[model samples]
Structures are given as C-alpha cells and as structure tokens.
Target: MKKTIITISREFGSGGREIGKKLAEQLNVPFYDKELIEIAAKESGLDKELFEEEDSRTSKGFRLLGALGYSLGGPLSTITELSLNDRLFLVQSQVIEQVAKEGACVIVGRCADYVLKDYDTVLNVFIHGNMKEKKERAIHSYEVDERDIENSIHKIDKRRANYYEYYTDRKWGRAENYDISLNSSTFGIDGCVEIIKEVAVNKSL
Candidate 1:
C-alpha cells in the first residue's frame, strides 16, 4: 500500500511544530523535526553538534560568494568545495530521502517539502501566523520578553528563509511552494490540527 508523507514548513513562532506533532499523533505516524539532523549526522558520519549548528541557519555571504565562483569551474570542484553548512544540508537531504522511502511520516521544516517534492504521495504544507499572534506565542512558549520576541522572530524566520532558499532554489513561505498554506492564528492550534487531519484523510482517500 502507498503511504502519505506530510512535509510542513513554517515561520518562526508560528506553532508549526506543535501542529505537526499533533497531526502525526492523530494520524499515528512518526514525526520529524530537529531529529532529522540527528539522524543525518549518524547516517552521514558527520558530527552531530556541527549538524545542529548549521541546520536552519543562514549561510555566510563570503562562503556563498565563493561557492558561486567555484560552481563555474567543474562539477567535481563544486561538490568538493561546498561549505560545511551546504555539506550538512546535502547529508540531511539524503537522510530525508531515505526516511520518506521507508514509510509515512510527518516531517517539519529543514526543506523536507522540497526534498520530497517529486514523491506522488507527499503533501507539502506551509504554516504561518500574523506578527501579533506569533509574537504572543513566542513570548508564552519560549518565556522570552516581549521586547526580544520581535527580533527573535525576525532573526529566526530570516535564517529559515535563507537556509531554504539556499538549498531549494524556491522562495520560502510562498503559497506556490506548498500544497496548502495555513494561517494557524485563524483557527488556533487544535483547530488547525483538525483541519490538517481532515485534509490528510481526504487526500488519502
């Protein structure tokens, strides 16, 4: 039987992780978030701490510039010259592909949607919330000061966007990049999970 794999990409402070977790529970499937990096580290023989350090973070401009220049040389040169972050991305991408091939799973972030884009049974989702709601959620969930939340939100989202764009050649958070784009603030967390579950069931049928 075919399996359904849902890939969720979200903005910072949007509660996408919670929604993905809940959706996985409702569907009785495994959920992957940062754990993907761990698996990738183990599978690829890369250091786990280095994987965590580079995951979902922006690439350095100098390194990207160097990579661009190096790409003009030859395929072998380009591959050999990849920055540490880019190498980690490649490793994690392989791990993601392996996991998807294994069975059904709900994968959150790390460009999993793009990694699994060619799979017929995969559903890609983007979750986002208004700035106000996101800030409130960040403050409550992370126990951070209100003043710091805005900057934290922007910083993290920018990093995610950069990381995703760097790897996928796609605009992050754009509706065209996903099968469904949800505003989690509109219906709240549980409601959003229910809606996703309903959609998953319908899609499976």
Candidate 2:
C-alpha cells in the first residue's frame, strides 16, 4: 500500500494538533508534533529547550529590531552567528524530511509543509479558527486564564507566522500556500479530522 503524508499548519488555539492526532488515529498512521522537536534535538545534539524557543520566534525578534543595529547593520552581521536555534532548525528540517521519507504520517507545525513541499505524496493543510472560538478553546483546553488568553494567542500566532515566513518562501496561513485550508471553528475538531481523512483517502485513490 502507498503511504500518504499529511502536514497540518494551524493557528495557535485552533485545535489543529488535536485534529491531526485524530486524523492519524483514523488513518492508522504515526502522528508527529513535539515529537519532531524531540527527534530533532536528539539528531542535532541540541537542547530541547533551545528548539522550543526558536521553533517560531526567530523572525519576530529581528523584525521588531528593525534594520538598525542588529537588523541591517553591524549587529545584523553578528546576528548571522548561528545561535543554537539556527542549528536546531537546520537539524529539525533534515529530521522532518527523513520522517516523511520513512512512511505516511501526520506532522503538525514547525514548517513541515515547507520541509516536505517537494514530496509528491504530501498533502499540506492549514487549519485556523475564528478569534472567539480560538480563545474559548485555548481557555478551556489549555487552562489559560481568560485574562491571559488573548495575549497568549497573539504571541503564539505571531511567532508561528514569523517562523514560517522566515524559513519558507511562502506566507503562513495564506490559502495559496496550502493545498487545503479548513476552519476548525466551522466544523469543530472531530469534523475537521473526518474531512481531512476523506480528503486524504480520496487523494490517494
């Protein structure tokens, strides 16, 4: 049997991870999320904490700094110094490619779509939810306080966007960048998983 690889890119509180896990279960395939980080860390000989920090925040810091000291000038050259974060990203990118080549799996975030964009069998998906729905989900699922949910959402999404844009030539969450874009808020997590499964099975056939 031919294997199918699904890559899901999602908004911070959209339950995209849950959907990916469910899809993997339904498809009887391996599911990858933070497991990617762990694998990357082991392969790259980098600390897991560094990978977590650099996962999606690289571009934001540089953008905020502007083309000033570290942005475009001498400090920028210094910034070129590959921090542990850069090394981790490079290692993780390789690991992601290796995993995709091994078999069918559902990979969530960390620019897996871009990493495997050249693969003919990969199906890339972008999952997002409306602000209200996302916030509610974050609060309930993550146990984030209502007061902190909005800020957490913003920070995480921004970091994800920054990381994606920095690494991939494509824009994050843009419909054009993905083979399919689904709103988890519209169908809920399980429904979205079902949709993904149907889509994957149909595509394989």
Candidate 3:
C-alpha cells in the first residue's frame, strides 16, 4: 500500500486497537501501540517505566494541574522547564515521526494524528461505540471488572481525551480532527478494519 501512516484515535473499549492491528496485518505494515513506549524508551535512553507511568497518568496529571489552578496550555508551553510527561511526549513524537519517515506503519494513540498532520499519505481514524456495548465489551473482551466497568470505561476515555487534547491542542474523538470516524458497534471490528483498509488502499492508489 502507498499509504505510509495510519493513526487511530479510539474511545475506551471500542476495539480501535484491534482494528488498527488487523488493518496493519492486512496491509503488511508495522503496528505501534504500547510499542511506541518501548521505542521511545530505547531511543531516548529513559527508563521504560517512566514512559509507562507518564503514559498512564495523563488524566490524573491534568486533574492535579486543575487542583493547582494551572492553565490548560499545550504541553510545550514551557520548553525549558519540561515535566516528565512533556519530555516523554517529545521523545514519543520524535519516534513517531522517524517511523513515519522510514515507511508505512499503523499507530494507535499517542496523538500520532496530530504529530503527522502534515503527512499527505496518512489516514487518521477515530473509533467510538455505544455506551452499553462498550461496557459489555470491556467486561468480556478487555476483562474489566464488572462491578466498576462503566466507571472504568469513562475514566479511561477521559484519560485518553485529556492526553490527546493536552499535547495536540485538538479535541479527541472529534470528527473534524480525523479523516474517518467510525462506530465499532455499528460496523464491528472486522468491518471497521475492512473499511479503513479500503479507504487507505484507495487513497494510496
């Protein structure tokens, strides 16, 4: 395929990652998800645990900032005094750009869509699902605790949204921010993969 990059932004429990992985397999390209963290850690010579910790703390960090009466300026507002999260974001973005420059890859999360916004051959997709179905999927597919499944789903989604918005200055899951916004509940995982693959292939051709 001629499409060099595909970035997927997804709601919690939406199977967006799965769709991305399957599409990459079909298109014969590299896939990056948690792998981005690994790549960033290695390339930046930072502890992998640091990246993982900051990666998971985006929402809590935002809340802490709010509690401290901080503004919601973008992550790079203070270049000289960067937080660990900011540092990780910078390294991660570098890795993303390097990989995109090298060749085709499917990237999930990490605000890759915004990072590669200038790429002419990139397709950015957002995946969402009905609340009821998402809860069910979380419990069964993702093995989330049933007792707090609903709360967990919302919390994770909030975390993702905060992370994307904080770094990219764009609203996460917003249709205008993505080339394609799909409903997993409407199209299912395989269907979503096929549709995205078709679009990517046609764009490449």
Q: Give me the candidate number with maximum TM-score.
A: 3
- Model 1: which residue pairs collide? none
Off by over 4 Å in 2: 1-3, 43-80
Candidate 3 Cα outliers beyond 4 Å, as residue runs: 43-80, 203-205
Candidate 2 global CA lDDT score: 0.75
Count of clashing residue pairs in every prediction: 0, 0, 0
Q: Per-prediction TM-score, please?
A: 0.79, 0.78, 0.81
Model 2 TM-score (2 dp): 0.78
The sequence of per-residue lDDT tens digits that candidate 3 reaches over residues 47-139 is: 453445443345443333333333347342342344777656666766777788989899998888887888888998999999988998898
Pairwise lDDT winner, candidates 2 and 3: 3
Per-residue error at 7 for model 3, in Å? 0.4
In model 2, what lDDT does residue 167 have? 65
Q: For model 1, how does the per-residue alpha-carbon lDDT over 125-174 read when each residue is reduced to its tens digit?
A: 88999999899888898776887778889998999998887666688989
